[model samples]
Target: MAVDLPGGVFRMGSDTHYPEERPSHRVRVGAFSIDETAVTNTDFAAFVADTGHVTVAEQPLDPAQFPDAPPENLVPGSMVFTPTRGPVDLRHLSQWWRWKPGACWRHPRGPRSSIEGLEDHPVVHVAHADALAYAAWAGAALPTEAEWEYASRGGLDGATYTWGDEPRPGGRIMANTWDGPDFPWRSTGESGFLRTAPVGSFPPNGYGLHDMAGNVWEWTDDWWTSRHPDDATSACCAPDDPRGGDLEASYDPAQPQFRVGRKVIKGGSHLCADSYCLRYRPAARRPQPVDTGMSHVGFRCVRRPATVEGTP
Candidate 1:
């Protein structure tokens, strides 16, 4: 199902959170429709069955693209999160994230794992191209970063969470974020999931959108910039449905040799924790490489008013 949102102006970033979301500013988006929840395993299976489409994670790596990669590591695989046995250095994410062979959407954990009973969970291990392909097949498009943040705010401008100002209003868990304070090691299992949860497992946002804060990180159409541009000079000057940085600026400076572009990804996943990654909020944003897919990344689609119902 999809929700028809009558978009309007809202605060787009968070100065209170990570630096990437600084310069909290107002932005406007045109009316659009967005999927109520992330695309699920059942949905992706149908698209694959109909189009015989192949996901990036299922394709062998190009040696030229990974000249320094070991020969054995060139096979198809995806990054999977493995909880550490005990406390480890939180600064190094390598402690818990591993490159698991055969860990595509079909096999979330690895070749040994399957999505047999997880058809309703958000599909993971999907790269930006895979998401775009599915959107095209479904006669939809990926949401722009502006449109996504506007929809996620759900009329609560500048609220910390999609629901309200409080993280857990009235002591009720609003979204499916990491359960315990200890991350990458111990899980209290309070959220009822250590990974992706079923769509709509938690309460919907004020906009009738489900999983807007967590469950899985969602791909956006905007290229990534280190931080949001300065706020518009005035309300009338606020950029309408603003786009993000240019392709050249989206490349990671730390790994310039790869020349890979990145896009903005919103909605922190189930792995997000208060102690580690406190990003399960509407304003939080992250940059993800366009060619990479991980076990916690998935996407939903959007449709502008100008788009025909059954046409992209």
Candidate 2:
């Protein structure tokens, strides 16, 4: 199910925090339709059964891509998040992320983990290619960065969240996120889930869209680029199924070392924390390698919604 977005220009980033969100600028998008929620496991299952689709993580690495890595190291794989029983150093995120063989959307959390009861959960462990495949099968397409942000803004102008500027008004947790001590303390499910929740489990945005800001990092069709106002410019052209400009040698002002070559991924997930993640806001984004997929990554779809003439 998709909703027609009578697209118009909107401020796409924030300047309060996160350099990538700085110099928030105006972007005009043509009218388009977007999926009401992130792609669900049930949706993916149908695609697989119909096309006998095999995700990149389900197939051994093509020797062409892993030329430097040892042939023995090449294997069908995905990234896995190793939960810490107690507080551990948060400085290095790599300590928690590991490459696991045979890990994909079907085997999210790795070989032992299963989606048995999560048929409705947003499909994770999905890389760029996996999302593309499903979108093609659905006769839908991935939302460009602009479309995703525009939709996520939910008709709210310059608002930090899809709902509004205040993430938790009256101290009520809205989206799915790590509420407890994060690495050390257990998730209290204060937001209703410790990990990935079923799509639409939380409150929908003004657009009646669910899981737009949390649950998992949703992928966008746009490429990497700068958040610096000086470097940012109006999308020169508005083309159907538009993709953002190429990445520049820009630094996410907040963390310059984390440079901006990686493509932007939106919708922070359960792993997000005020003490660590600080990425629950709509403008907040992270660069992701197009080839990598993990337990926290998922995606939604978009199109010029079907409606009366001049109705997007």
The 10-residue segment of model 1 with minimum total lDDT is 303-312
TM accuracy, model 1: 0.97
User: Candidate 1: which stretches are off by over 4 Å?
Assistant: 307-312
Q: In model 1, how large is the Cα lDDT of residue 121?
A: 98
Clashes of each: 0, 4
Give the range where candidate 2 is weakest over 10 consecutive residues by summed lDDT.
231-240
Candidate 2 lDDT, 153-180, residue by residue in tens: 8999888788887869778777888786
Using Cα atoms with residue i matched to residue i, what is each candidate's TM-score against the true structure?
0.97, 0.86
Candidate 1 residue-wise lDDT, 1-312, digit = tens: 999988888889999989999999988888999999999999999999999999999999999988998999999999999999999989898999999989999999999999999999999999999999999999999999999999898889998999988888889988888888888888898878888899999998888999999889999989999999898887698788899999999999999787999999999999999988989888899999999999899999999877577774
User: What is the C-alpha RMSD, rounded to one decimal, of candidate 2?
Assistant: 4.5
Candidate with top lDDT is 1
